[model samples]
Target: MGNKPSFGETDLPCPQPRQFPMLLWLLLLLILPPGRDQSGVTPKAFLLLNPPWSTNFHKDEVTLTCRDSLSPAQGDIYWYYNENLLNKKSEEIQIHKTGYYKCKTQRSSLSDPVHVDFSFDKLILQAPHSVFEGDEVVLRCQAREEAKEKRFYRNEIQIQSNFTLQSVSMNNDKYHCTALVRGFWTWNKEISKHLMIQVQELFSPPMLIASPSSPTEGSPVTLKCETWLPPQRSHIQLQFCFFREDKALGKCWSSSPELKLPTVWSEDAESYWCQAESVTPPIRKRSLRSQLYVQRIPVSDVTLEIQPPEGQLTEGENLLLICSVAKGTGTVTFSWHREGTVRSLGRKTQRSLSAVLQILTVKESDAGRYYCAADNIHGPILSKLIRVTLRIPVSRPVFTLTSPRMQAMVGDVVELHCESQRGSPPILYRFYHENVTLGSSSVPSGRAVFKFSLTADHSGNYSCEADNSLGVQRSDRVILSVTVPVSHPLFTFSPAVPQAVAGDVLELRCEAQRGSPPILYWFYYKNVTLGSREAPFGGGASFNLTLMAEHSGNFSCGADNGLGIQHSEMVILSIIGPPSNKTTLITEGVTAGLLSILGLAVTAALVCHFRTQRNSERLSTTGTPSYSPREFKEPSRTSNTNPQEPLDPVEPQPVYNNVNPGDSDLVYSEIWSTQHTNENSANSPRKHWEDKEPTVIYSDLKKAYPDDSTEQASIVDSDLEDAVENYENVPCVLSALDR
Candidate 1:
């Protein structure tokens, strides 16, 4: 009766052969009993408790109620602690110790075991690893397990549940777990620490910091990302990324805290930031936004431009000096200055890329070398030195013809000097004579001197002009008269028929073509000086004289200016009378063309006579005899006419009154006539003058002498001559008869 059960068998009989060992049976019993009943129907067995997990603090007793689906009402409950049986036949049991516990109902197999933690320091509220925007966060409070009358509170809200299940964290809500005990309420309640569920702003705007603050173009720049997370979760591993205006930059998905640019160009100018994200929790954070800019370099090809691109600068005109930078940005300042001047001619301040320094009214003093400078607060750039010269227009020029004397002589070298009072240097001068250019000369000293040989053609109006780059200016006209020596004089006579009768008038003229004005002309007969004449301006002179029987002699004329006197060729004149034979006297020196001046009335009468002679070649000598009037005595002689005669000035006549042609062969003769003698010498009465003489005066006088070689030529005989001689008693008449 005292036999113990062996390891593999017992005294009792069994149908199965080779039963399992005790340890094996125990494992089989634990694996197969909870899912089935002895009647071969499936039964469900589970534990009912006040909470889900264990706590560390002294907690309320947990009523572990085991239930089976096979049982309708109350059933026997079996309890175990650390795999050892504790009680049976109770529907529920209360436990206070922290250990492995399990239970079974009378109609079910043993249930799974649960572990309890009685350490109060470890009883805490736990939350999800990350809480992001627009996401649900689950929070759990762990305290006493499988206890009745458990209460869950969150931010002072009570949920009607025996145990805290889970919390969905939408904001930063506080959570805790508590329970009531079957014992007294003084000390058996289990409570958990409050848990704060934080709904974090997972990603904030990122802030960026640049190295070398302002970077120039084509230079390197380093940007840093400044982002952080909550202080408590700072240990979380994160990855860094960079962005610019919401676009990813180079190596955007990196873990580095900074981004480096090898060179910053113009295209890199934009707003940039960085982001930091947790590796596991997928939480991302960004820094505040920052702007990045790349600086522009200075222009290299700076230039200076002038307006009016051509011509020189003049006073009272607007001048523009443009100082410009072809490539650059921002404010640029321009300045203009002369080379020798300390002050700048102009200055301009502007924000544009180019600036112009303008001089509204330029002055003559502004002439000098010029240059320009530009600056944009970096450094000054100077343009190449440019020279500007102010041009002054030439003034009225003063012309001087340097004649040794006041008179300009032919074949003399004359100096012409032209100058302007106010003008720029390098002036050109030109001389003009009668509107024809004589010469041109250039001089830098504002005056030009030219030399020219004077001639008769140069004796006219003289003027000069001065010219520079500005304009041309002319001087007043000057009259230039060149003195010339007189040429040979010429003598001529008018009324060129035959020899004139006694008391006939003769016209004589003297002329010279090349000489100065106011020439004096003189008439001469057989080496005796007659009268003289002077031309008022420039030309020749003429004279009138009466002829007598002694007028037959050599004649010439002379002309003189300031030079010596010049004489003309000599000529001979003859005195003629009417004769018995057919005689004719021919005049000479009519073919010589001598231009001479006469009085206005005399010239008009001569023109009328010429016209009449041209119309009628000859006049009728049968009409009543006409005699020409006597001319006033002015001592005059021509190349063929003499002044030593006592003849009236010769005028063109058709015929003499009461005179008939005796057809004389003699060119010269004397007249003798009979007259009444008185006893007393003073008591003679004159004969009638209109009565026709025995013959023409010339014929009667010539016929009074005895004919030596003639008979038909003689109209009167020697006895007639003796009768006339006995009647006249005058010495002068005897003298005429003696000739």
Candidate 2:
């Protein structure tokens, strides 16, 4: 409150001409917030001091100020220090002691207290934020002016005779300054707080490390900056950047310790480094160069090549095999193997990525699948299996004869099984009889069977030959005896080539030639069993049929020995009666109608026969015959391969028949007779027509018999022969022809 020129003063000193007090004051007034007191005048309360806010043991002058926006003063002010009240009208107060001071008014709230540090404390040391190696570092100490001496210490080491702020060409250290006062038996010294100067190794060489240490092409890698500063400067904020030798990479400045790379290509295998920089002082350090060598892709597309590379491996021959890479990168190990082996036949580890395997002599065991493998750290790849085969001449073959009986006989199926013991697969076996090649068969395992019906011609020397790629070997000859069955029985009547009268001595002879000794003969009259006779020696037998109406039927005989039976041709014998008055029984009307129907039926049958023969010839010439059923009402047949399942028999492809009413429509009476007449009938047109494709029509016979009648009936439906089966009808046919 007193005007003692205190440090906290209210009045301002006169401004120099360069300051222009009036303009400066007006500018200050314009900038301050408008504050009006209760007296209707703009007023503000503030404090200013001379020699700043503190005094060093009262060595400097003190002043204070309380300025207002409108005028220096318009209201009464109050001042307080250390809670000591001064004048209520005074606006400023100052004291040279470490204490709180403030100003207040009735309209204005109390201002914040300002504490001035005026303790007897004395030492001060200054250091810069950024310091470099060998740079001048300044350490200052300030204490009471009356102190006899001042000293400085770095890291607790004393430095004598330094009174003013100290300077040295050193960095990165801690220093403390102090003043010693000689007080005649008392000691008082001012010590400064420790001041540390951070020295940056901004020029220290940095090192880089590739994270994962070893990298491969096409895989990602991380480059890290491995560097450090002095322990004292470890806490300083820094940033890092990466570069590919000279080119900057992504985000040159990164707060992260390391930079992540997406991928590395072959071209990325080059030198790289990093730079570390201090943020505050802007110091940068370059890192040591590092090389990144990326490994390329592994081996691919491997193959094995044969040395000779023609035909196949042969027995007793040396073989050379090579396993090589078609395309790949980097080192690889090559290996070879047989099909059924786990261990490699040959293996080599080389940068060339190829290997060779050799066999001194190829044997049957080596005639198998072989392959090669290309292996590396990446994975193993295999080539396709190569098939090697060895060929050797076939050895002498052994012949086997398979027959149902010890002596091959007619009607017996004989099989000659042929095989070679040692030979490559698919050896052909050919059967020969008396130097004549019967047939040839190929067997993969050098085995086959030739089956044929035994005949007298087959009863001779039999042999077989086995052959392969190399050569053929024949088996020695072996005799084969075939027993012939009885030939067709020769049946004859006593009166040869003549009709028999009712009283003629009729004798029938049945004989067989070329049959084994001892044969039994059976005589049939119109398929009726008459009698059987046996000859102790292979010869003829006889049967007697009295010349009567009952004996006037077909006569045939069969001879049977151990071999199968053979039947003779039927013999016809008709009795001619003298013209006389004899009563005959026949339906006039029925007979005429039946005869007309028979004629029509015969004509249709003949027309169908002719058409079928032409169609069959055309079909045979074309080699294509189509077959389709006439009805779809039946259930569809499913296809099956099982032998037990009955096969669907093919239907005859119908051909339209054309016949003139009077030409080529004749049906001879003898053709319908039960008796077999002329020898040329064996090759007769009737028989030939029966063998051709038939005309399938909607006939009543089909409906009458149905498919359920006989076993496995063909599409044509077997003819019943009902008329000729009744031998009595033969007389009627013969009589009609005679008429």
Candidate 3:
């Protein structure tokens, strides 16, 4: 013990290897910067109470230590009470006053608040100042002196002496403790005051904020996560994240408080929110959901379309106008206008890209240029201009027919004119006869004319039609009549024989081939009119004339109708006297031999006696025989016969009938006798011959033979005396010889 060194000179033991490392770490913390840890995260500042008591009597003392992730030597501590700063700079503080207390470090955030209650009461119940969910809690009863047999109760129920809770949370249940104390002479019971505990939130629920609440399409947008931590837990690191509906927008967990979007679209309008969470403690919170809506683009590329496509408008038709835009949305307004109109023709408001306006029964006044406009809160856009025109249809036409004469004759020209009251230009006219197309003509304006020569086939109904491509119009029908003229006529005389007696009857007839009704026929003899007759219906006409001496000249007939007159060839006629019977001689074998000769001689002597007596009378009367009837007049009928032809027959007695030899020659005979009385030179034999003069018979003969020429040779005799004298020169000798 004497050899031991003085107290100040004693040696100390060296530290262990594990303990040396811990000491080295503490040294490094004291020299490093404040707040930030090894991971570059700033830790929150906090305060801790010494002895860990909640409530204390008046004038009681408590110690508060401002703590952070950094060592105390690295940063100074700050203190606050009731949101007021304290002047102290030490890491530890002691106070006897009761109030809300908080603390922070120079390089850290503020800590959570703590309530310290300083009461004047004798007995009180004690518990932790700041309580959180899932934390261990302890309850105690205290008084001015020591107590025994203490008991505690929650709300009104008794609890064990340990007075402990596992995973405690906030509550308003009253907690009290009762204990027995030794007072003056007897043991007294003391009861502590009731207390209630409040639980603090880890961090306020997160709030999401959007930068441009109402955004347009194709523009930028920003989102932020807003939250706050308790002052006591400010050093806790929190991570941020954003989501749309239930899907994450970008990184699931990010340290940034704000999330950025390059562009937003119409499809991006949906529910959105953000989340904030502590990194170590796993305290997570979500913000309230927000809806983001994007506006649509403005109207553009306006256009107008027509319904017919061809743009052809006709009278009494419907017109349609369609206005539209290539890209637009929401409510839209459309307007239609004409070129010269002050007001819009039509207007429509709807949620579609196109609109239509219909005009029923289009007319001529609707023709003009047109356009359309569209708007959707933006300026109006116009479409290209279009023009419309109208056309008119044809109207009923008028047809007329004109001719040169009142009564249309064959070969007359007829004119047809067609016209319409209302129609477009370049009209076509067609003329029809009896519903058959005659001809067609085209004219630019006014009426059309077509002329055609009249014919028998053109005597029917006529109509005309006009067309201008819209429709065809026809006119009422007109009737036509045609007339024909008469042709040459034929004349004929009927008797079937060349010769006829003075009392014979004859017929003359005239006819035409083709003529109108009521034809008049005239009969002529010797170039003089005999009589006239008319055929009512259009055939031949005939006249009857008794044969007379004046009717022996040439005969002809003519036919006359309204059109013209036509004449026929002339025909010769003859009138002759009846035949007489007397004693005659027969030659050709002389069959009546003796009787014929004796009769002939007797007849000759009588003829000689009369001739001698007549000759003596002629000598007494200047030697010329004048054979004349005292009151005889010349016959009015003149013979048209050959003047060289003798009045007597070449045969002793020739026949006057049966004379048709395919030739036109004819024969006839006439006889006349007269008696005279004279007193000078009277002779008996001359008187017998004069008596034999016997009614001097005269015969005119015109003969035609079977072998005669076919040429029609006419013989005309003007003198009646020459024919009688030629007959007297022949015959007295032949007469006496035959007797």
Candidate 4:
């Protein structure tokens, strides 16, 4: 070194500017350690400080050395101060100036710039120009002579004298010192300029790295914990650890810087990081977290399930078809198909294991076998088949009643048939009579029949019901009439006189107690037909005629409906001429009294008969009748119109015959009629009430022929074995017969 220029002078030699500075940067790349200062360009060269302090006395000399990775003998060294060139060629030099200095080599880039401070003041703060992080450092505050007292500060804060930094971190801190020195005889105080300490990094932070960053499932992976240390500190032992989402990937701590994974799965996709620590210094560092993702497995084992469970689904109901996969990952496509259809019923694409397709309203056409398929990146997988059947609701049931005869007579066995036109069976059919259930029957696919024995109560309205689970349907009502056979009738005449003369008027009545409505009655004389009258509303019929000579004979009456005709016992009738004038004149005096007595007696007898018939009817209706099931014989009709007979329906209510009080030859009689249900007859009632046999009561008032004046009245009761008692009162008779 010839002579070093002062830092304040800008004029210096320029060594003929060459392109080597640019070429040097391009040729020799400086690979920096990890976590090296990121704020500036990387430096290929560095400076070594002698005495280690940047601030020193002006008279003190400091040695500087230029160090680089290149060989010292292969390149000459150049030096700069405050960006100005200096005349220096050796790799080492001595300086006593305060300025920023840098160096370069012929084959290497420029080193990082450093600052030096030379002070002429009495007080100075001394610290190293280049200090590494985590290094123990000592600071000194000095004066030209011994100080009586001294004080120091760090970062503008007062600190104790002789302060030492133990394991100091890489921080830029301003330091200064204040010293009290004895100058001549008086004491004086001096303060040094603030110096900022610069700390160099010893090693770089660790970085986490994965070879083949994106790995497939079941594939191997390699993980490395990367870091760098200074060449001087390269011999320091370091330990590394690898982690995934806070869980250790290998041994918690290992000397090896790498971790190997033989196989990875989808669950292994997570945040990963690495840690590096020095064994001697116990310095630890961690890398920033990185994300690792593993590919997924393929879709397989597809299946389809129907909502509402079984195949017993009804029409007009919502249907749900679910498609699922036993194992799959990533985006999946699901499709539902019917066995006989060309297009899929539904399709869905999503990141899920199952998908659903709903049909708002199912119909009969939707009944079929169904299946589903699922796919990912791999091929499609099919599910097992499922059959769905739609049940049809039962249509309005058709209800019908059948019997062996044209009419549903009592004791006849009839069948009630109920069927549904369109529906699924096993259908249940219930038979109803007058809105009340009689019995029930069930069939798999067609009509169902319930056998019922007809009774008087079973004659009203009839209906049937058909039901499946889906819904219930009912049929319209059918009307049935239970026809009953006519019983033997009672024949009688009006007037209480003993006999009837040729000139007297006569009335005859006939009635059948237990027969159905619309009964026909025939009046006969000596086996010859008189005429017929119809009692369309039931109870009885009557005929009126004048007693003539030809009418005197045995009189009888017959009653008939459609079932059968019954005839009454014969009554003897003998007609004579009118009374003699002398006798008539003799009885005429007491005629008023006799007429009153006869009227009272007749009224009493008629009332008693009516009450008895009413009682018998009430008992019959309340009790079950005994029945002998059989068919009744049909009646024959004969036509012989008589001029004396009234062809029209003479009366609908109870008949009352009028009598002439003046006619002493006229006779009146009250008739009581009753019916018997034969035990062997098919139309008989099933059970008799109180176990009582059938009986008929007859009471009559008669008048002898005018030749004799005797008047007779009698009562008779006849019991029929094993017969139901059904009775009715005959019409009252009040007729005047002239003698």
lDDT of 1 at 366: 71
Q: CA lDDT of each candidate?
A: 0.61, 0.63, 0.70, 0.72
TM-score of 2: 0.25
Candidate 4: misplaced stretches above 4 Å? 1-122, 126-140, 147-194, 199-291, 301-327, 331-335, 339-366, 377-386, 389-397, 402-417, 421-479, 485-511, 517-739
List candidate 3 segments past 4 Å from native.
1-99, 105-108, 117-128, 131-189, 193-208, 213-332, 339-366, 374-386, 389-739
Clashes of 1: 31
lDDT of 3 by residue, 470-519 (tens): 88899999888666566677877786456677777788878888766688
Weakest ten-residue segment in model 3 by summed lDDT? 1-10
Better of 1 and 3 by lDDT: 3
lDDT of 4 by residue, 81-137 (tens): 766679998999999988777777654556657788888999998877776556667
Give each model a TM-score.
0.32, 0.25, 0.36, 0.41
If ranked by lDDT, best first, what sequence of candidates would result? 4, 3, 2, 1
Worst 10 residues of 1 by lDDT: 1-10
* Model 4 / residue 84 / CA error / Å: 24
Write candidate 1's Cα lDDT for 552-658 as tens digits.
Answer: 88888988887688899987788775453433222223222122212323433443454344324324543443212111122233432546744433322211111
User: Which is the better candidate, 2 or 4, if ranked by lDDT?
Assistant: 4
Q: Every model's Cα RMSD, please?
A: 28.8, 32.7, 30.6, 26.1
Worst 10 residues of 2 by lDDT: 1-10
